[model samples]
Target: MSLQHFSHQHPLVFIASHGHEIEKVNCSACGELVSGSSFGCVECGFYLHKQCVEAPAEMNHPFHRNHNLNLFTRNPYLAGTIICDFSRKTCENFVYHYSCNLDFHIKCALFSHSIAEKKNVEFQDISRIDPSINTGNVTEELKKAECFACRKPLLDSIYFSPNCGFYLHAKCVDLPAEINHLFHQEHPLFLQFNSQRLSCKICQKPQGPEFVYCCSPCKFALHIQCATIPTKINQPFHRKHPLILQSVDECLPCQICQETTNLNDFVYFCSICKFVLHIRCVSSPLIIEDKLHHEHSFTLFPRQVLYCDACGTLGNYVPYICSTCGIFVHKNCISVPRVIKFYRHQHRIPHTYFLDQNESEPWECRFCLEEVNTEHGSYFCSKCNYIVHVKCATKNSRWYYEVDSTETEEATDSDEPVDLREIHPHNLILSGDIRDFKQCHGCLLPIDTSYCYCSQCDFFLHKACAALRAKKHIWFHYCQKLLKLTSGCIFQCCMCKYFTSGFAYTCDKCKERFCLRCSLLSDMPKCEGHEHRLRRFTGESKELCRGCGTSVHAFICKPCNFNLDWNCITLPLKTQHSFDVHLLNSLITLMITIIQEVIIVIFVKRKGIPNIGFIIV
Candidate 1:
């Protein structure tokens, strides 16, 4: 018999299987197990459930009603993978395919209709939103039930079907299909079932086959709970200001815990100062385990009562204390390296929780050059008498932990040159020749051979200087270690009793001068501008340098009638005078020419020797 259908040519016959004789098979219409009465054809092996065969051949879904959808038993594409456009799930059985290339599962279409109709029949007794939703008495058996919509635990007031024992969360039933969020402003996010297990970009949570707010074109997904997170929040830890949620494009570490914020996760930012905190770091555990510090668990305390055992400074906030061993440490000090190879020490130093007071000699921290309290935490070396305070060892950008101690301490040149990112633009070569006339650009100390140098930039750094962590907590500088430029002036070098017009590293907290010559550079050759070999002449003399006619203090030059001062000898041959528009050359000739013109005037003025120390060079 002819019947109105989408795919079949002839009408399917109503067949049934006797309880003892007929075989069982799956119905093609709904892909469900069929044993009893079924509408099917034996010739083509095509089958359908009696109820599925009665389903309409055309449907107008509430979600997409631009055009009527034709029911297709098999994928119209015939071979390509067909996914329901609405739920983004693989289409298993019947699909309502429209001419506009849209497809949806039969179940999803019915759910859409139920949602559009605002079905509240089952939830009439249980309010959708109530303040006492979680306060109600719930049986243990019913507490295990999950919402049918989101598949989450039915903790909130939910609608329950007594007959089938089906449950649905009140919030899940009322969730909107589409929404616009501030984080993803480019497109409207739609409620979709994520089967690919893509991670949410906002909270960095993995998205399972659950309802998530997603943007199809951008491929961005956020969990429903994560999407509803407030834009601003005030936690007890930071009550002074309300933290605002913001997008961070860079890897910025949280100021409190020193843990970096994920680029994908939202950050609670404070615009007033350079303060940033990670969302996860806000509610840090009150008690946690630290294997490196103590054998027992640590309990976080509200106030700082004493100096930190790790850094030896009075903490600014709460600190962790081990009740069993009486070890006090800063929260930021938990991840300190267990073993480290410092530039000043030859042997590998390991972290020590307590020092032996019975030792013959008192323990001294080599970093600060001060007596270390044996009761506190510090890095120690038993082979050698090396000890360093926790803060002194791991100060911002100080010690490098990127390489293993064995490999970093190895005296081998097989390793490739490394590019010191923000420190220098060129690659630095490792050199261990303190005998060479070179200085480190970082510390301005002589390269004793254990140093890194860049020939192109004329830069040098002690191996320790090269391995310096980008951030550091220097004892001399009050603020953190920050690189700064030096104006071309006579700024006295802090370490060496010399003057430099070159760059000096400084910080915001202190003006402690540190020139590269004193920190990194060592043995050096004669000055380039002067003709004679200059020496470090610190002698009591009323002599003058004829080069600029200035008093000679300490200089590097061969003995001549005209002694050249250190600054005059090191002057660049070609210099641009502020008053002059062009670069001037032949400085020696210019001085001689000026002196020649003065010599004629001196003769006429009747000069008797004129202290004759000054002469044209």
Candidate 2:
């Protein structure tokens, strides 16, 4: 259970001695055999634990399964829940019966099935054929078994249960009662195992239906409930009030005593008066339908006034609101969905809110990329021009959007595009036919051939870019606000320490993840490239490179020892320098007149001149 660089393919690997014996088993995932090597792969029934065939396949999940699943086994006789034809929601789908006891991630246990393994791990030789493979040669006929599927104790990693006397923990028998959840796949899952009191659409409280997903077609449900949520909550009819997730769309009055908005769409208020209320009054399945905003389906408005294109203000309470196209909200503003994967937009952007300005000049929100308007409240995208607020569209479902469904995509020698194996280096190809159509140049979003592309550079990327994360910036450190990830093995280039590829930019406050080939690597950095304006000094590094003074790492003027790297410390303050004049920033007034003409030619050639240094040269 401790082991983790990562490996667990059914191969829990044990050998045994005490005269205790079941004798043999096979199939960590297509190993086949199992008549007494115990069981797995009948036609791909797949089950394991002679030590899980030898573990080490791949993992990273949540209720949001986009890809990153490969590990299967289970003798068949199923029980389901693998739903993700692409965000319909149901644990993001990944479950196997004879094996995956309750875990998931093999494309949610066979979505279209056939998960690209390609073939590699094949090294046999326990001792040629079988001293019984190990525990053999000494048997009283051994057969104490007991795990048709949860009978328990087949001892260290076993799984006999396709139907019978019992024995699974071979880690709970590839656990697949049914699951296709990367955030609810079209819904069609099962496994109640009793425990159903229900209640909590979200905090109404009282759970236990095992873990919770349910959907008998569309009754719709979910519950893991309680990981941590209590920033501010108190409702004895508002109780003097104390609320703050800020950005309240309208004027700012009825947050309780501040008073102003009254009619409807006003989620969590009373900062002073507007007095809005209704996250479900308290919470419960009151109409939802979100595949990260697949066009429209949010209804809950109890009072909704109208204004709030994102945050101009007007609407009042009960607002999980959609108003069709205009904009009017407040239904607890959405939120929740993360399981590993992030490049920024391979189709993982939930927890939304907005609906007003609609976009004319100012715009930004492509799922928390930021910069929006309407007084500071937005989330528009009637289908992409973008707009965001509700604190940049409610981030923190834990983040996962790694989309790289490739056909061929590459581009490095500095044209900028770390790696986009399946359209999502923040996506930006635009044309078409990367092997029959692909697109997602960062939210332009669209794809059709299964995906993972970027072979040479036509471009493509999708498994959500393996969950991009970079907002941990370090222009010179202590600035933060990063976020731009995709995946890795190395990643150090906020602008050029090398070791990079596949874009990056993370920072939830400061785990710091940089990479984007160092944020542009240089058109201006040599020794803090000083034309002026660089602060902070903490310790001391000498500093020097204004393009080629030599000794610089990136941003460090501390009064002009200067230094700039990370791609010239994020260049582009404004540059055109040619065709229509746009070079601004005067390069420190041309490096102070070339150090004032070399200090007046060394003060008149050291006074008294060698012929006055030829009349000051």
Candidate 3:
């Protein structure tokens, strides 16, 4: 006779006895092998035990006395899987659920009810028959005996078969044989021993020889803990679209941390926008409060941007914004240093958003030698009129160090108005006015204004140059030795290779010489001919100097393709020559005229010139 059931669509036929053809059939209600009398829907491949087919829709089980357990064909929760309280495994078939977070499999609920009534049954001595069991002071032997179901130690309530050496947790003995998960919907996952040591696709963690939900054909597996992760989630930061859990083979950058995700890691992705976020970044904080960077708090702006106001570099993804300051900056730029001491400059520089504009002269960066945009942020020294790009100042750790805001800068002798007798044999007087032209003995540059002069000898030094220390450490020198200030002999500079009679910083150990101008130059030198900083040419072959057209040691401006030799770099700004009636405008022009004169003399010598003796002085 055919019987209608609420769980299945088709009418179930009563099978009075199990035959060879239906021996392997499992009950659809409890997912257990059906043995005795049962109901079968041959067309749908569905079956159920006689007791399960006659079970009531609602009942007050003794295990949960507070509420009535209602029968459910599928999980009632909107997301994630439901685990049975008795089996400790996912409930994929019919279950008895209560609104108060209690659930049980159909067979488990029936067997539990039968035991409560003291029915005649085999295996009545099972430990699970008694709800309470003493688990205190468990011996080492019992601790070593792990449950065959979950692979966890059977320290508490468990079902033990001494003759068969089979151990199972009280709650694990009735685990469902198979389950269907949201992560993999192609096939039903079966509860099996993880003998191959496969990693869970959801958490990407290696699984030991334990029970897991696995699909043999697809080689997909998931731990019981990882199988509960929801397939879709609504993150607070990304509210436009709900992110779906997905597996990716390529490394993609996470929008929150701006770091590349590991290959083959599970990520929360938005298929509609192609937005990817690392699984870890899903819980990033919405707001950050850093007192050191700014007075106001910064809120995370969860969108891609092109620029950052702090570092002035291209921003990749999300940026932090301070609404009070009306600025958008990178997350990494929030802690940028406010004041720093650069190795190239004597005074400390402070960060500023915009420089004070002098209409006559635009601000130029001392490091890159490029025009500074007054609208953007930069490092500036108001005392020395020195300014540099923010990136150039803090590019390298060895170039600068942060300075405390409250610390006072040390005063130099140049700032003081006094006569010095210790520096020279005669008292040197500081004067702003001098009638005759004088050259500084230290740097050999023209001392036009604010200089120290000695009456006993022709000793003169620029006010700033006279404040130099007796010994100093320069970063450009590889010897890492302190160079001493020495004078009185002409020597070639190791850096610029220029021969000069000016003061030199000499290293006694390596015998390396550096002229005053070369020693004072930073690693990146400023040049007037080009709009960019010049770097030393350390190539194997000599570069052709653009100034004199000679292949020699030179400094190059790569962007401009400009090169300057030492001889051209150190040429005085103004010079007096007998061949010119007025003072030569520039030493560069004088050198060019000399080159032209030599070329004319060679042409005259090759042809013939009568009594006009072409002489070059």
Which tens-of-lDDT digit does each residue in 133-182 have in candidate 2?
44653233224543322322343353322232112333333344455543
RMSD of each: 18.0, 27.3, 21.3
Better structure of 1 and 3 per TM-score: 1
lDDT string for model 3 (1-617, tens) is 98999998999999988899879999989888889999999999899899999899997654343457899988878888887654456788999886666677787677656543435263456434221455564567666766655566666455554332345565654555577998789998866545456788877888764667888668788876566567789865567899888887778767666566777778888767666777666666668777765678888886667666776655456778899988777665677788887766666788887666565677656665567766667788888778877777777787788888779975421334222444467878899985555667777665667998887897899988777766766656655456777776656578765545667888888999898776666556677757887766644567789878999867778667788876566565654443554354345346645664666566556666543643321
How displaced is residue 524 in candidate 3, in Å? 8.7
Model 3 residue 231 distance off true place after TM-score fit, in angstroms: 9.6
For residue 447, model 3's alpha carbon misses the true position, in angstroms, by: 16
Model 3 global lDDT (CA atoms, 0 to 1): 0.70
Judge candidate 1 against the unseen true structure and give its global Cα lDDT, from 0 to 1. 0.59
The collision pairs in model 3 are none
For model 2, the stretches where C-alpha displacement exceeds 4 angstroms are 1-328, 333-371, 375-388, 391-393, 397-617
**Per-candidate count of clashing residue pairs (backbone under 3 Å):** 35, 194, 0
In the range 1-617, model 1's lDDT, one tens digit per residue, is 42434556657777765244436667776565777776766677777766667667787644442456788877888588777654556887888786566776765555545664676454566444332554565567566766655666666554554332235666777888888998899998877655445688777867554667877668788888778777898755455678888877667656556566766457887666434667666677898886654457877775435566666654344467777766667777765677765644545677776654458676656655457876667888786666877767666464534234445555312133323655577787887665534544454333455777787976777786566433222223323334354333334466443444344655446677665443333112355544654444433564587677877564533345446554455443443233443324234335434654475446535544344334221
Top candidate on lDDT is 3
